[model samples]
Target: MNIVVILAPFSLALALIGLAAFWWTLRNDQYEDPQGDASRILIEDPEDRPL
Candidate 1:
């Protein structure tokens, strides 16, 4: 019963931190090229190969 008091606020704070991080990513356009990276691997570029 005493643990709940400590855990509840801790859990809420953790969730808020996670939400803040997600919001930061959205504002920074971190998700803009989601598909680009996935499809880019299918192409072969000379720059990516070792000389």
Candidate 2:
């Protein structure tokens, strides 16, 4: 069907874009602090305390 021809390329383009974004994050060390973020939630900021 004609729809398949159009949809196939569109889907492939979306997949490629997602892959590129993932690769960019890898090269930028965006995932280096995976555990830091999780533990950070348990830590409180001193500025947030009631005076």
Clash pairs detected, candidate 2: none
Candidates in order, TM-scores: namely: 0.78, 0.82
Model 1: what TM-score?
0.78
| Top-scoring candidate (lDDT) | 1
Give candidate 1 regions above 4 Å deviation. Answer: 49-51
- Which ranges of candidate 2 are over 4 A from the true structure? 46-51
lDDT of 2 by residue, 1-51 (tens): 999999999999999999999999999999999899899878899986679
Task: Let me know the TM-score candidate 2 reaches against the reference structure.
Answer: 0.82
Ten-residue stretch with the least lDDT total in model 1: 41-50
For candidate 2, what is the lDDT?
Answer: 0.95
**lDDT at 38, model 1:** 95
Count steric clashes of candidate 1.
Answer: 0
Question: For model 2, where is the 10-residue window of minimal lDDT?
Answer: 41-50
